[model samples]
Target: MSTDTDTPGGDADTAARSLAHWSEAGRAEMEAFYALATEDYRQLALAADWPTVLRAVTHDGWRVLDVACGSGKFPTALDRYTDLSALPEASYDLLDPSTFSIAEARAQLRPPFSAAREFAVTLQELPADAGPYDVVWATHALYALPPAELAQGAEQFVRALRPGGLGFVAQATAQSHYLAFYDAFRAGVRDRTPYTSAEQVADALRAAGGDVRTQTVEYTSGTADRAVAEGFLQRCAFDDAVSLDQMEAAPVLGDYLAGCRDASGAYTFQHEVMLIWL
Candidate 1:
């Protein structure tokens, strides 16, 4: 749910800012994300596999701690894989840096996971003794963490999980849309922070002493609507202040967008995802 790419957040002031400011960008990104993600998922049968894995590896009962539990999409996906009656003792804990997102997570974390405890803090801010969870999960939440913070966040997840517990993370590859667009954004416009690639995250997990496994999934997201395409890139860069018109006028952005266009003139984004877990 973390909208910020593996983008390195600035000093404390930026970290402390309310996420309400990002709603416009988030909404803009989600619209484009939903349209393309659905098409890709259907084509590849790329459903989330977390809940199935959880059901297979659990004991009598367990607890789950979802870091940056972005609007609870994972929990919703979990319901599709199992019933509430099957895991009566299962408890959920939600953690996110956004206060606004905490409320959204509460609203969307259906049935079994709705009763979760909430933690409104970044992974780097999460206390070391905060958990002994059966599962520690971070979805698209870790994009904006700086290198050092990214390392700390990964260590926190490894430490948060109990012995024999599982840790899962889903993030974009270096060539993925989120990463590539940001790369272009920086090159064409101002120098913004870079996204933390999935490889870096997997390495951090392994460094934490967890036996890590990985899989790469590829997909393409394309839309013919120029408005949607422009908005998606704006939001991907986390800069809602810039308009599509401005992006087009910029020499570098214009060249980059030109490259992203297909024969049909639809803006196409090539995405490669890395799914890692222990």
Candidate 2:
């Protein structure tokens, strides 16, 4: 959800391509991406008792900001895997650089997540007077955020929180599937910097003066369908132009994908995500 446009030190051409893919024209790519990526949200939903977590930070009129919210998958996952019927209604603000994503995420809101404000801006561009929210979260949403801007972005994130409020972020570490695979993709298929890592995020938050606590969640999502695997991998690289066969033939990426393939030829992606609380 954190588009590279506003991220300093990001690749402009790559950022433009990534930004274009989030539009209506790219719906197919989005769907294909979500086919396997939905597991990412489901896994996070099961990571904790979210209702309790929300209740712990809720107040009479508490508000929540979903940073770089992508199709509102986190709240949708909460609705699917947990009950939020008893919680007090809270205003939910959506923030993302993509208008399509903002609309998609807004449509997914339910009770206890009454849709309120919509911010069509990158994290670095978030208005200074925007929020003092009781809950702020970004679920696997900061991958495109440039390393140079992580500290500033983290500062804005921490600044948005109200006193005694809760802040949460979920991201893949350097060795996780998302990060590792992207590294290989850049090496074999493209030439780009690695995606931001969870460790970097935690350090940035700490630099912003946040007292961060972390939990690790490990899981695997696999598919025997080659189409699904291809779509998943293509989405992972944000390059639908590349075919599965091409990926399987690349030097570094080919070896990486082969390592993930089992005897049945199913591709299994291993994920290790960090759940950070501040």
Top model by lDDT, which number? 2
Candidate 2 per-residue C-alpha lDDT over 146-216 given as tens digits, one digit per residue, 9 for 90 to 100: 66678889999999998899999999999899999989988888776568899999999999989899999
The 10-residue segment with the lowest total lDDT in model 1: 11-20
The TM-scores of all predictions, comma-separated, are: 0.83, 0.95
Candidates' C-alpha lDDT: 0.69, 0.87
Each prediction's number of clashing residue pairs: 6, 0
Give the alpha carbon lDDT tens digit for every residue of 1-102 in model 1: 333423444533223322444354476565654555544334322445444566664665578888876666666555554454454456778888776677
lDDT of candidate 2 vs native? 0.87
**lDDT at 114 for candidate 1?**
37
